[model samples]
Target chain A: MKLTILGCYAATPRTFTNPTSQILDIKNRLFLIDCGEGTQVQLRKNKIRFSKINHIFISHLHGDHFFGLVGLVSTFTLLNRTTDLHIYGPKGIKEIIKLQLRLSNSRTNYGLFFHELESPESEIIFEDEKVLVKTIPLKHRVYTNGFLFQEKIGDRKLNLDAVQNYEIESCYYQKIKNGKDITLEDGRIIENDKLTFDPVPAKNYAFCSDTVYNEAMLPIIENVDILYHESTFLQSEGNLAKKTLHSTAKEAATIALKANAKQLILGHYSTRYESIELFKEEAETIFPEVLLADDGKSFEF
Target chain B: MKLTILGCYAATPRTFTNPTSQILDIKNRLFLIDCGEGTQVQLRKNKIRFSKINHIFISHLHGDHFFGLVGLVSTFTLLNRTTDLHIYGPKGIKEIIKLQLRLSNSRTNYGLFFHELESPESEIIFEDEKVLVKTIPLKHRVYTNGFLFQEKIGDRKLNLDAVQNYEIESCYYQKIKNGKDITLEDGRIIENDKLTFDPVPAKNYAFCSDTVYNEAMLPIIENVDILYHESTFLQSEGNLAKKTLHSTAKEAATIALKANAKQLILGHYSTRYESIELFKEEAETIFPEVLLADDGKSFEF
Candidate 1:
């Protein structure tokens, strides 16, 4: 899986800094997360194909998180997109986007679907044969939800040597790979474990942002291969972070450590901080594996 | 008058090209016209002060024309703006913006007002002591209106040499500048023309964009000091321009020539063209004094 950071800063978009937006590529599919203003331009700069984005997940209704969604939807119509597009966000998101489209008299040439979320519990929002996505309910000033993407384990691999030794027919390989025992015409049964090898482990990625230092989500994101958490402030601004319902670097690191996340990625930095390196310095004091996210940066795992 | 082209391209915004948006500084007041997506970043790149912009004029409800207004309004709140902001656009603009703000639960610290326009005929939309702005109704795919910015005629300038020669006291200088005849204590009357010189000729600028080659607005924009007209296509693609309800370079030049404009600025170019110089070449064949509007380029007249 690959994750591309289109924008990672907080608050207003500036000349050099952008608001929250990212692209996660897993199972050969692209999912856009939190499309902030100027996101289309950033998508162009990163050379990401616009048509590949089939699903978009918004964390909240803040302008910094989803203001660019309408522009992107309008641009898709101009580009003659014919594929269906799905959007998942808070309950009020549909009204915001539909109002703009209606006012502009713009009708999309493709099917547009909105799956508004108002639930406060963690539940699966998307699932397919290869992947599953669920929401991690978050605490914020407004209704918000973070998404968890998990890849399903593949079928066990066939051990050619073991199958040949057992004189298994090629037609019976399917059942062997499905962890079923093979039966011969002589009434002899061969164990499936002897004919197949273990499958590769599946990977899980959790995205959390715009939340405070709450441990309620720890159970949902425990042992995630990669965890992307918002660290909008530093340790020195802990009070301000609490007052604004945002998490500081130290608080994010503590959550990552308590959840036993394999690797922690820090993002959604407040523009008031001059250097993002300070966040790494603070996070490393608690969590040994920490990564900083910046605009146009990418990571592969 | 100084006009800054924040974005002059047509259609979707790209990494190197932007959509429709510009800043017109007339009579020491900044008037934002047609705020497309990514306008706030462009404003910062152009070094424009956010506080000075009290008024915004949108030509139409097209995404490329007014998609950036919501983000700009949200940014104003983050910046703690306390001044009133006025927006003049087509009918339904208020509903579009208010819906987004309501969904996000964001309220501006400053006053926000919208003046919706649905009239097909030309009329005055904004007027102050120093400037007057009127709508230049244009024919487009949607209900569109360009803007005409005119500097109101100022009081006569005081001729210091003449005033000193007449030994006029400073107390009567205000009356002299107001073009009033001076009456001395000895009952001598001096002509106003002899005591003051004519003020600099008030300049007028017309912004016409996203419209076809229609001549209905020629009377309103005649003798304009500077005219910025949209030339979305070259002569080779004039058929497409006609079908899209956009103006060709040659067609725009014809309008400028017929209107007797002093200088013609061409912008809102379609990205299909390889070079913008071809537009100037096509326009110069019909009219002289043609200038090309590029992103980040400024024009003074």
Candidate 2:
């Protein structure tokens, strides 16, 4: 899976800085997360096709997190998009979007679906044959949830020599690759494990943003391959974080460390901090495997 | 009065190209016109303060015309702006904005006023002592109107030579400048022209965009100092202009010529034409005083 950081700045969008927006390319789909303002322009700059974005996941109703969504949806209509669009966010998303479309006299030719997420527990919001996604309920001023996208383990590769000696039918060989043993034509029993190699390990990506320091999410996103969490402040501004219910860099790292994530990506920096170096330094104190998220940056795992 | 071109490109926004958005800096107030997508970014790049712009005028409901409005308004709230914000646009602007705010639960901290315009006839929408603005009804796919911003005639400047001869009270000097003859204490009648210089001719700006060739507005916008009209296509793409209800370069110049404006500023160009020489070439054929408008390029008249 490849994750493209379309925008990572925190709070308001500035000339040089952008707000939260990310694109995850997994299972042949581009999942947009938290479309801040200028997301369409960012997508254009990254040379990503607008139609590729089939699903959108918004963490909360914060302006910085989802202000770009309406414009994107409008542009989709302008471009005459026909594919269905799915959006998962807080309960009020549908009414808001419908109102704008109503006022503008704009009706989409494509099917638009909304899945209002109000569950406070870890629940699967989306699932397919290759991937499963669950929300990690977060603590914030408003209702918010982080997503844990997990790629399921695939079918194991077969040992050609074992399959040939077993003389199994080709159709039965397919079952063996799925970790199932089948009886041979000569009545010789062959175990699936000896004939097949282990399947590729599932890779997991956890996205947590616009939230306070909450260890409750660790149980759901525990030991993910990569974790992206909001770092809205530094330790020096810890009091401000508490007042706003936003997490500081140190707090984000603490959660990442406790979750035992392989790598931690810190983003959603406050507008007050001009440079992200302070965020990286603060996060590294507790979580040494910290990486600063930058707009237009990409990572692969 | 100064007109700053914040963004003047047509079609979709790119890193280097932007949609239509301009700032008219007249006296104490900053007025915004036609905010397309990425307008806030364009404003930031131009180093314009958000607080300074409390009044925004939108010509239509097209995505390329007012898509950036909601984001800019939201950004103001995020920045904790408490000043009153006013918007004047076509009907449905309030619903579009209110829906977004409702969905995100992002409401203004200060006063928010909306003056929706649904009248098909030209009318005075804004008036102050120093400025008077009216709509120039236009024909397009959607109900649309172009704005005409004009500076009202101001008080004349005193002629120091004439003032030395007359024992004029300083407070009454303003009345004399307003073209009223004032009698001096010594029983001498001072002609208004003798005591004061002629008031500076009122300056005016007319905006005509996204419209087909129509001469009906020529009389209303006649003798304006400067006129910025859309020239979306060159003579080569004039056929497209007819179907789209947009103007060609020649068509815009014809309107300028008929209006008898001091200067014609042509923009809203379709990106298909790589070179602007054709636009200038076509417009100058009819009106030699025509000027091509560029992105972030401003002109003074």
Candidate 3:
């Protein structure tokens, strides 16, 4: 899986910094998360194709989180896109998007689907043969959710030499890859483990932002390979973070530690800070494995 | 009067080029016109203070023309602005803006007013003692209007030597500046023209965009000091321009010529063109006094 940070700053987009938005490439699908204002320009600058974004997930209805949505949808129509697009967000997203399109007299040529999510419980929102996405309920001033993307386990790998030595027919190779023992022509039995090897472990990534540190998300995102959490404030601004329903660097690190995530990625830094290095430094004190998210930065795991 | 081009492209915003938006400074008021996406960043880049802008004029409901408005309004609230903001646009603008704010649960601290315009005739939309703003209706894909900003006639300049020669009292100087004949203490009457010169000629600026070559706008913007018109295509693409309800550079210059404008500024160029120099060259063919609008470029008239 590959992750690209299109924008990581908070509250407002600046000349050099952008608001919250990211792209996750997993299971041959590109998922957009929280498209803030100016996201299309950021997408263009990052050289990401507009057609590749099939699914968009908005964490909340805040302008800093989803104001760029309508613009992106309008641009898609302008480009004459025909592929069906799916949007998963909190309730009221459809009204906001439809109203703008209606006023502009722009009827989208593509099939636009909105899956309004209001459930506060952890439930699978999207699933396919290769991947599964679930929502992690979050604590915020408004209803918000964090998405957890998990790659499904693949079929076992066949050991060609072992299968040939066991006199297994080529047609039985499929059965062997499916972890089933094949009967020999002479009525001899062979164990399934002897014909195949275990497949590579599936990787998991969790995205959380615009929410305060909530232990309720631990069970939903437990033992994830990578966790991206918002660190909108420093440790010194803990009061401000609590008041605003945002998290501090230490608080995000504590959540990552409690969830036992392999690595923690910090983003959504408030613009009030002069530098983002302080966030990493503060997070490292609690969680040793931490990465700072920056605009245009990409990570492969 | 001074005009600053915050963004002047058409259709969409790019890395270096922006969509339609500009700032017109007249009579100590900064009026924002056609706020496209990413306009707030452009405003910041141009070093324009948000507090100075009290009025915003949206030409139409197109995404490229007014998508940045809500973000700007949200940012103003975040900055703790207390001044009232007035927005003038189409009839449906209030619904679009109010819905987004309601969904986000962001109640603005300042007073927010919307003036919806659906008229097809020229009428004054805004006026004070020093300035007056009228709408010049334009033909486009949707309901649209071009704004005409005119500085009201100012107080006549006092000719100090002429006033002293007439032995006019200092208290009567105010009356003379108001274009009234003054009676001296010795009962001698002095003509108003002799005591004071006529007020400076009222300067007028007309902003016309997203329109085709419609001669109906000539009377509304006639004899303006400066005229900014949309030139979305070149003369070679005149057919496309007409189909899109846009104008070519040649057509814009023709309007400037017919209206007898002092200067013509060409903007809203389509991104398909390789260079903007072609627009200036083509427009100058019909109108000798022509200026090209570029991002961050300012004009004084």
Candidate 4:
């Protein structure tokens, strides 16, 4: 799995800082998240293939989260895109996009499908053979949802030596790998656990942003491999953060700690701070494995 | 009058090039024209004060022309702007903006007034004491209008020696400046022209973009001091330009020549061209005094 941070600043985009956008590549699928303004330029600077983005997920109706969506859709039409583009966001997103397209008189050459999300509870929003995506309800000024992308558990690995010792036929190897007991020719049964070893554990990532410090999402994102939470302010500005319904670095760390996430990534920083290091310094106090999100940064697992 | 090119490239914004956007400073009023995506960042990079822009003129509803407007409006609200913002655009622009603002539940602290235009003929859209803005209808794939900014004639300057020779009171200077013939004590008439030369002939600028080779605007923009016309393609791609309803560099120069404009500025270049010098080379063929539009470049007239 790979993740690329296109932009991570909060409130407004500046010459050096962008608002909020990211690209996640999991199981050969490229998913775009929260396309703020100037996202297309960022994608060009990062040299990411624009055609690879098939799915887009938006957290809320804030301009910093979804303003770049219509531009991207229009650019897709200009580029003669033929692949169906799926967009998942809160209700009313479709109207905003359709209105702009109508005014411009642009008809997309590809199918633009919108899956409006309105559920207030945790639910699986997308699932396939390789991955599953679920919504993590978040508390914000507007209706918001954070997405949790998890890889599906794979098949068990067969122990060739153990299978050979048990005189198991080649045809039974598939059953053994599927965690099923194998029957031998002598009417003896070979246990699946004895012939096979467990596969690598599934890895999962959770993205939460533009929300206040809330513990309701702890159970839904429990033990996630990586957690990206918004830290719009430092610990010193906790009051402002609370007033704005945004989280401080310490608050994001507390949520990561409570959820037992392996790694915590902090982003969506307010431009008032001179340096991003302050966020890392504050988050690391509670979560040992903490990283600060920077524009154009990439992480692989 | 000063003009700053924030972005001039056509179609999608790239890492090195931007879409259509400009700042026209005339008569102490800063006017933003055609805010494409990334315009706010460009304004920041150009060091233009965002608060000074009270009026915005959108030439069309294409994404390359007005995609950055909503973000700018949202940023204004975030910055606590109280000055009323006036926007002039097509008939459907008001609905597009209001719907997005309504969906986000953002009520602007400042008033946002929209002036919709659907006239096929030229008409004055805005007029103040020092400036006048008129629409120049253009032929494009969409309903579009080009803006003509003209500086209103100012008070005539009184020749100090001539006024003193006539022993004119200071109170009467205002009337003389207003082009009134001052009555002499001996019943001898002093002509207004003898007192003051005509205030610098009112300078006018015509902005035409995303249009084809249309001569209908010649009379409206006749003898303009500066003319900015879109040249999306070169002469070799005349067929493409004709099909897209866009002008070639040659066609833009032809319009400037026919209009008898003092100077011609070419912009809205297609990304297919490797160098901008090609546009200048082609335009200068028809109009000798031609300049290429470049981002961050400023022109004073």
> Could you report the DockQ of all the candidates, in the order they appear?
0.83, 0.56, 0.83, 0.85
Model 3 docking grade: high
What DockQ number belongs to candidate 4? 0.85
- Model 4 lDDT per residue over A52-93, tens place: 999999999999999999999999988899999999999999
Tens-place lDDT digits, model 1, residues A1-301 = 9999999999878999889999999989899999999899999999999999999999999899998899999999999999999999999888888877887777899999999999999999999988899999999988989999999997899999999887878998888888998887798888888789998899989999889998999999999999999999998999999998899999999999999999999999998888999999999999999999999999999
- Lowest lDDT 10-mer window, candidate 2 chain B? B6-15
- Report the C-alpha displacement of residue A37, candidate 2, in angstroms: 1.1
**Candidate 2 off by > 4 Å:** A78-80, A165-169
Model 3 agreement with the true structure over B53-159: per-residue lDDT tens digits: 99999999999999999999999999899999999999999999999999998888999999999998988999999999999999999999999999999999999
Candidate 2 per-residue lDDT over residues B1-301, each given as its tens digit: 7777876777566667778899888766789998887788888877888889988999888777887888888878877989999899998899888877776656888789999999989999999999888999998877889999988888998887787777676898778778899887878787888888877888899988878998988878999889999999987787889998899999999999899988898888887887877898999999989887877776665
Residue B257 shift from truth in candidate 3, angstroms: 1.2
DockQ class, candidate 2: medium
User: Chain B of candidate 3 versus the native chain B: what TM-score?
Assistant: 0.98
lDDT of 2 at B23: 89
Candidate 1 stretches greater than 4 Å from native: A164-170
Error of 4 at A32 (Å): 0.7
